[model samples]
Target: MTKPTTTPAEPPYLRIVAAIRRRIADGELLAGDRVPSTRQIAREWGVALATATKALTTLRLEGLVETRPRTGTVVAGTAPPTASPALPSTPSASPVSSASSTGTAPEQELTLERIVRTGMDIADAEGLSALSMRGVAARLGVAAMSLYRYVPGKDDLVLLMADTAYGEESYPADVPEGWRPRVELGARTLWTLYRRHPWLAQLGPISRPLPLPNLMVHGEWVLSALEGHGLDPTRLFDVHVLIYSHSHGLAVHLEREAQAEAATGQSDDEWMDSRAPTLQWLAESGRFPAFTRIVGSLGDGYDLRLDALFEFGLAALLDGLTPIIEGREATSR
Candidate 1:
């Protein structure tokens, strides 16, 4: 006697992909029309953001969707791929078994490096809040438990990811001349890393600094520049902290903005525009004349450009420190 075969249930992400695909095929979603964002999909389906992201990725792979700058994801201008009975799945063979059977290393063979890189990729795309061991496993096409073989847990994995991200940049062999230039280089380097990986700024508070080796590399650069400037050890370290905080304090908003967008599905401009009524009310209340006068002077409203602010702040900070650092040099002479 033979038993009947039962097909496996469709994955949540694929189901989302199919539903969106249907809308495109049925002409409900026209070409170049805005599609539901990942956050929207997550809310509508009660799925995790990772699942939502995967659904969109699947749609993109099928040519059903393409992302546009400032427009978010949209239906592709080109026709989507022809429909098939079902989406394809990975080979049934496990990574370990495949390696043994083929006498060659399988590409999917799990490793510490692969796990860390995948985690970093997830944190980079979505904010750190969306990152999870299960999401990393789903992205890698492996069982979640399998990750434990390489990493102890999410806490350790995040440290590894942070260290790897911090290591991406390095100082040149030919160092810049003068303490100010060196300090500036170090500060800008850290800022660049934070900009590249906004979630990095959210790692721990200033009181509990991350003890990552690559992070130490950055600290070493700044500390080396400040050394031998006739300042006491405490003062020199305080100066280093000040420089770090200047960059870090501003960079913290990068992650916050990303989180806000994900939660509200509104861009910075859109969010601010939505609050215009309140601003006008405050202006009319006349309780804050200085604020109203300054804001009303701007014809098109102010655009808060972080990059410009960073540069301006850096210049001002460096200018203020110049006298203090140089004064120490003169006193020592």
Candidate 2:
């Protein structure tokens, strides 16, 4: 008798891709319809966020879906290419193979710096939530297990990525004349980093700060600026926290807006426009007269310009702190 043969089970991500592909084929999901987001897929399938991301990536590669700026990922308007076999779970040996083909660099070429940089690139393009060990490995063209040889896991990799990004900027050796200018420079430098890496703002809470060496550099800059002022140690630290909070609080919205756009398939302007009816209702209700008046006064809709807001808020904060720093006020609290 011939030996019994058994087929291998499909990977979770490929299973997800097949389900979605079937929906598209059956006409249940139309070309322009928004597909389930990575989060949604994860929740529904009881799978990891990484798996969901991989499924979406596979679909995109197969030309079954495309991303739009204001709109989230939707089925491609054009016909998809001829069906292809599911991607293998492991990296393929053949150079001309499908998605699993080894990356441009061989496995031996992998280094911690290269891995961290690749992770940063992914996090830069997609929000932090989209990042995964598997995704990074796939991009690097190595097996997922190969990454463990360098960074232990995703958490450690993210920390390395954050540290590297923070280390990009440094304070000048010759400081500005006044404490205010020096403080301004430090705050602006941090803001620039946050602007470049919006995901940085989402790292941790105020109580539990990330213990990154490069982040300490920025902290040192701010503390030095406020140190010689007449304020006590407590007040000095308090003011530093306040300044840092101002930059971080505003920056939190940067990643949030990106995530929201991806999740809801709507831009800020588009989201606001969708709420027009609610706004009109609120205006006519006569309950919020001041709000209605101010909103109505604008010839064009108010544009939420974050950079302008940052500058305005920074100026106001500094002006308020001037008296405290100059010893004109008894206490900042």
Candidate 3:
């Protein structure tokens, strides 16, 4: 049987849709087989719900799946009229029994596309530390060795997972009137995106980027925000890099706290209460009179409001950036 070749235009998610169609045509996804729900596909493919939904909807429209009474959406008994005529075939079309007889045909459906998706979800809910070939295979219900057929190593899997999550949203077609608004909007979007997959902030940028289309789009937008200031490309990119670094650097610790608290079943307040006596002892050391002055102002021991910290840092960054940006504007004029 000949294999299908992907075209330059084929997106990762659409490729997944085509692979699913092939599985249905080849009988691997038999009629009445429960198709994976959108959430599962998102987790499995590391694609966003929008991408997963689009793929499933494409399959549904093509007649590969249909909603049935007393059953959720499933593979239809008959291929939809719109299914590709050249849908690929697998061993399911002609069962093979030999030393090579794997339970499921080596369906191309289990492509790198699927591995990255599942890995992303694991990393998103847990953290990058939680993502592994063994973890992904467990989710796929396959032997750990089986995943080697897809992702090369845990590193490649993680890079792909990061890219897949980054592809979830699009930048605005046009920037707002001012750099302040544009940067604020863009930064907030990234913050929210990282918040959704809190592990994203923890992933280092050292690895070659995953050719993430959306992230590149965001880069273009950020560069445009600095356009009128006439900064060199390096400076423009540096500004963006520094701003995101500030946001994510702080967020990494925040997410770590969240994960730690969840695992240990201890709230921040509770943990701090236990540490209070030590903090008070340090405060009482009259050797540090200036430190005691501030503690007295709060009427309690050092109040560490992380939310306030994030806001204060954000405001300070923007305030500090203004002078530099104004200087560039002055030079440009």
* Candidate with maximal TM-score: 2
Put down candidate 2 lDDT per residue, 247-313, tens digits, no spaces. 9999999888888877655455545654666888999999999999999998677999999999999
CA lDDT scores, all candidates in order? 0.78, 0.81, 0.64
Q: Mark the 10 consecutive residues where model 2 has the least summed lDDT.
A: 84-93
Candidate 3: stretches off by over 4 Å: 1-111, 205-213, 262-265, 299-308, 328-333
C-alpha lDDT (0 to 100) for residue 233 of candidate 3: 70
Estimate the Cα RMSD of every predicted model relative to the unseen true structure. 13.7, 14.3, 21.4
Q: Write the per-residue lDDT of candidate 1 for residues 9-85, one digit (tens) a residue.
A: 99999999999999989999988787887667878999876677778778877878765433456787943333111
Per-residue lDDT value at 9 in model 1: 98
Candidate 2 C-alpha error for residue 232, in Å: 1.1
Error of 3 at 286 (Å): 1.1
- Estimate TM-scores for all models: 0.71, 0.71, 0.59
